[model samples]
Target: MCKKGNEVDKDLHSLQLKNFMGLLVPHQRQIHAFILYLVVNRADADDILQETLVEMWNKFNEYKDGTNFVAWGLTIAKFKVLQFIQKSKNYRFHFDPQLLELLEHEAIRKNGVHTHNERVEILKECVSKLQTKEKVMLDLRYEKNLTFEGISRQFGVSVPAIYKALGRTHARLAQCIKLTLEQRGVA
Candidate 1:
C-alpha cells in the first residue's frame, strides 16, 4: 500500500510538471510577442511576460485540459498587461497610435492569420516622443481602461479631477499622434 501511494504521488507530480512545461514551451514566444506589442517596450514586455508566466503557473489548475491553450494563455497575458499598464509610470509616455493600430490589427489577425510586425515597430518610435505625464495619463485612461471614477479612487481625488487629467493628457497625446502620423506620411 505504501509503495502504491508513492508511485501515485510521483506520477501526479510528473504529470503536473509535464502539463506546465507543455503549456509554456510552445506558447512562450507568441505570448512574449503579444505582450511586447501591447506594452511597446522590450524591458516592460519582458517583465510583464514573466509576470504572466508566473500567473499562468499559479493558476494552472484553473485551466481546462484539452482546450485552446493559446487562448487561455492570451487571456492570462491580457490580465497581466492590464495590471502592468495600471502600475507602470512609463505607460503614459509610451502610448503610440501605431501601437494602438498594431494591437487592433493583431486582434483581427488572430481570427484571419495576418501580421502587424511593421505596425508594432512604428508604434515604438511614436511612443518614445511623448511627455512623461502625458504618457502616464494615457496609460491610465486608455491602456488600463480606468474610468474617471476608478482613477479618482486610485488617487483619492474627485472624478472631475480624473476627467480633467484625461482631457489634458488626450490633448497632448492627440497632438503628438498627429505629428507622428504626419511625419510618417500617413496623414
Candidate 2:
C-alpha cells in the first residue's frame, strides 16, 4: 500500500508539471504583452516574465486541472507587476493598479478579435507605404531577425541612426494599423 501511494504521488506530480508546461510556452507572447501593459517597461517586463515563469513552475502542484490557465498565470503576473510598481515608488510614476487590470482584460479581449492573418494583411499594406530605406530596415530587423547594430554595420550607418530609423518605421506601421482599424470601424 505504501509503495502504491508513493507511485501515485509521483505520477500526480508528473502530470501537474506536464499540464503546466503545455500551457506555459504558447501563451508567452500574450503574457509578455500583459506584463508590458502593466509595467510599461520592456526590460522590467522581461524580468517579470522570468519571475512569473518561475512562480508558475513552483506553484504547479497548487494549480487545479481544468481551470483557465491564462487567468491563473495572469493572477500571478499581476501580483509580480504590483510588487514591481510598489518597489519602484521612488520613480514618481503614478499608474493605478486597477487600471492595469482593466488594461489586461482589454488586451486579452482585443487579442481574441485580431487574428494573425488580419494583422499580416494590414502589415503588408503598411510595409508597402514605408520608404525604400525603411523597408530594408524592417526586412532586416524582422524577416532576418538582425540586431540594430548588425543593421548599422550593413548599412554603414551609426547604430543610433539604425535605431531611430527602425523606431520611426515601427511608429509609422502602428499609425497605419490605427488608421486601417478606424477605416474598418474596428478601432
* lDDT per model vs. reference: 0.73, 0.83
**Model 2 TM:** 0.70
lDDT of 1 by residue, 44-114 (tens): 88999999988988888889889987788888987887777777756465555567557946653653442
Off by over 4 Å in 1: 1-10, 96-187
> Which one wins on TM-score?
2
**lDDT tens digits by residue: candidate 2, 62-165:** 88878978778888998888888888788766468688778878877776767546777998998898889888887898899898889999999999998887
Off by over 4 Å in 2: 1-6, 89-109, 115-132, 142-150, 158-160, 179-186
Error of 2 at 168 (Å): 2.1
**What is the alpha-carbon lDDT of model 1 when measured against the actual structure?**
0.73
The alpha-carbon deviation from the true structure for residue 155 of candidate 1, after best TM-score superposition, in angstroms, is 49
